[model samples]
Target chain A: MTLEVADLQVHYRTLKGDVRALDGVSFSLADGEIVGLAGESGCGKTTLGKSLIRLDGRMRHVGGTAVLDGDELPIGDDKAMNARRWKEVSIIPQYSMSALNPTRKIGKMIAELLRARGKSYREFKDELVRRLELVGLTEKVLDNYPIELSGGMKQRVVMVLSTLLDPSLLIADEVTSALDVTNQRAVAETLVRFRDMGFVKSMIVVTHDLSLVYQIADTIMVMYAGRIVEKAPAETIIKSPKHPYTRALIGALPEVGLEYGDERLQSIPGKPPHLLNPPTGCRFRARCPLASEECEAEPPTVTVEAGHEVSCWKAN
Target chain B: MGRYFRRKLLIYGLTFVIAVSINFAVPRLMPGDPVARMLTRNSVANVESSEAMRGYFNELFGLDVPLWQQYFNYWGALFRGDLGVSVFAFPSPVATVVADALPYTLALLLPSILLSWFVGNALGAMAARNKLLDNGALPIGYVLTAVPYMWLAILLAWVGGIILGWFPVAGGYSFALTPAFTWTFIVDLVHHWFLPFLSLFVVALGGWAIGMRNLVIYELESDYSNYLQALGAPNRLVRRYAFRNAVLPQITGLALQLGVVVGGALVTEVVFAYPGLGSLLLNAISSQDFFLLQGILLFIVIGVLVFNFLADVVYVLVDPRTRLGLEGGQS
Candidate 1:
């Protein structure tokens, strides 16, 4: 395994109480494996990605252990975790448009960034230029300011910059969310190419768009509220999901070539439960169709297949 | 480029016409005969010879000419940089009085403006990085911003001058030191200027600090900052990147402030008795020195317009998103 996460529980501090954003998420990614984290908004997908690298002021790492390349990640302590970030684990944020500095020329910004990591730009300039070329950007772009580049170009520039150090794990947080379909496909393919080229060993692509993830991810994990309700191979998860929440969520998506009028798609009926003083038992119990007295107590994660996992009494 | 320049020229023309017209019309519409007011302090003494005073005022104030003709003459004289003679300061043109005061105001205003921006921005960046610093500094900054300039000026004068007796109370320089171009004289000038500059610095620094802090907070929450963080760029890199982007909006604001610095520091200058444009304008108004007031207002209006135009050009340079021709070319 290249990455292992065990019983990760992260919460956000609020005026009322602690909001459990990421509750007991456990998973492992094999070498070269690409996992797609599919969920609705506020489903702890982002929290999981953020926790793997750095936690912001509001996010408190209550309890969790993430092992990257058999080394324990010191995620909770920002200073301790600094050693692993960028060089080991990296992320391509959602909006790459405004990511670059507007004042400095692209080359100067990149040089300054490299120098910050204690590396001289002179040594890496060749490789950086080659990567830029691979991304279909010319050397002239380096001379131009960030505003000179188009949105898609900026996203690609950020992509190359993120993987410049060849991190062990890359967390691409909604990287394609802001792109047009064509640009999205291009960027997605570029990510796959990066993995194939050994720039990054394993990856987690977080998005609400299940179909897009279905096209890219080798395995898919579905999360509802703050917990991972289902995890399986991409084909298995898409064809036959065991968890009720996953089923409802998959059923909700309007797949390409499937018109709305052909078969009316239904959205999840109820909103995700508020995490502040969340219900005792299962967090999704309120919206689950299989809710029963047994669900009053939290259901343990059950492994029905060699690699597949589902946390539900019915799945067991 | 041509279109942009033409648009700017159009704006400048409109501003110049409106500002000059207002400057001309306002003085003419004032109730008291400025000539009579110039001649005698009491209105009763001038009232007995009001008709003769009106004729003298017509000749002296250019009211003898037809309104439209006078407007043209004023406009012509303005283009020629020949603002009419001051009523109170006999034989001296309004332009001469303003020119004499300009260097003093610029000297105080420029340094204070630069210092405020530099210190405030640095403090803002520091506050953004450390939550403890932000929490501690926020209230102090707010109090400073909210406190009126006049009040702060008085407080500083009382504390720094009267109580501590650490600095000079008033005036731009010492009477013992003769004015010269030598470094010694310059150093002495600066030493005396310390109190006035410090007073203005405190009053203005607060706004810059608060404005920058809020901007940085917004930048910190932005996707770019998070992206930079994910890139494992050090805290310093993240700060520089965030501050650079966040400070773009403030550049224009600072430039606007710079243009109006002459007119804007009225209260600060008045309280400190600084011989700057603000004090000059104050004296002009009290004496009903119409020409001087018109000249100063016109200078300020032109200064504001020019600075605002420079700010726009800067905006284009800083963020290419504002540049024309390329709209939504990005995906």
Candidate 2:
């Protein structure tokens, strides 16, 4: 295992109260595995990705232990986490288009960033150039400002920058959402290529587009209301999901060539429960079609097959 | 870059022409004639001598000609760098009087504008990082920015001059000594200059500090800053980037502030009775000295346009986005 997260709980400090964005979530990633974390908006997938790298100003790490390659991460303490970041763990954030400094040339900015982290920019310059080319960008891009590049070009630059240090784990948070279908496919392919080239030891690709992630992810984890509802091999999760929420989620995706004719695609009936002051039982109980008295109490996570884990009471 | 400058030069040239025309028309439209005012000030007792003087004065000042001819004559003299004679200070050319006072205003305006900008931006950037300084500086910045220039000048003059008697309240220098290059004269000049400069500096400082504080905070919260921090770049690196980006807008802000601050400097000078362009402007207006007023107004218009142009040039040099726009139209 490259990453083992146990009982992670992260909350957002809001004006009203603490919103439990990630409550009692536990999962692990194998060496060289790409786990796609899928969910609707506000379903703690992004929170999980951010938790492993950097918690924003509003997020508070209430309780958790995430050990990456036998070392416990200092997720709650920003200062302590600094030494490990960019080298041990890195992230290609969601805002890649505006990620690089607008005023600085891309090459100069990268050099400065590397120097600040006590790494020699000259030593990395050749590799940086190589990686830029790997992403189909010319080394001339280094001399240009961020505004000079197209959106997809900026995205690729950010990807190469994040993984340049060869981190043990890389989190790509909504990296493909901003691109068109063609660029999205290119970006997705680039991500898999990065993994195959050993640029990142393990990865968590946080996104909502299930069909896209299914193509690249080794395993898939579905989250609803701050908790992971199912974790299994990407193929198993898509074709034979045991959790009712996961089944409903997969059913909601419209297939490429399948025509609806007269009937519309199915959607989950009710919204996910509000995370602030969430109920005592299963988070998806109110939204699940197979809710029963057993769900009123917290459901126990069960592993029916070797790699499949489900947290629903109806999962047999 | 060439096209951008050509466009800017054309705009400034058009503005100058319109401003000069307005300057020519303004005093003529006023109630009293400058030649008549000069006659009354002289108070010649003999009617024949007074009539003779009036004809001579009107002809000398070009007031005896047709309006169109006078307008053409005004343009003709203006091109030759002749500002005609001042009715308020008779026989003295308007250029000579303006030259005499230009140094004083420049000394007061330049240091105040520059020092305030530097110190205010530094203070605002520092305050954005510290809560204690922010709490105190924010309200003080608000109050100082809201103060009128003359009001603050009067306050400073009253407190520092009348009550404390630490500095002189009026004039560019003491009446006890003539203008000289000696240390004593320079010291006395600075003593009288302190209050007006302080008033202008303080009022302008507040606006810059407030603008910069908000700008630095915004930059810190921007996506680039967040990306840096997430990548574990130190606070120093992040702040350096934020400050550089934040200062770009403030450069443009400095250009915009020049005209307004010039107006404030004039008012502050008048309040302290400092022998700068402000007091000269007052005398010219009250005495209806058309040539003097027109010359001063033209100087002010040219000054504003030149500073704005310099700001555009500096902005292009500092911001790559604008530079790219200049080279390739748009990205």
**Number of the top lDDT candidate:** 2
Q: Can you list the residue pairs that collide in candidate 1?
A: A151-B330
Alpha-carbon lDDT, every model:
0.84, 0.91
Candidate 2 regions exceeding 4 Å error are: B259-264
Off by over 4 Å in 1: A133-135, A254-263, B1-6, B39-61, B131-138, B159-194, B323-331
* Per-residue lDDT of B289 in model 2: 94
- TM-score, chain B, each candidate: 0.90, 0.95
| TM-score, per-candidate, Cα-based | 0.88, 0.98
lDDT of prediction 1: 0.84
Q: Give one digit per residue, the lDDT tens place, for model 2 in B153-199.
A: 88899999999999888999999999999999999999988988888
DockQ (0 to 1) for model 2? 0.76
Model 1 RMSD in Å is: 3.6
lDDT of 2 by residue, A200-290 (tens): 9999999999999999999999999999989999999999999988999899999989989998889999888899999888888888888
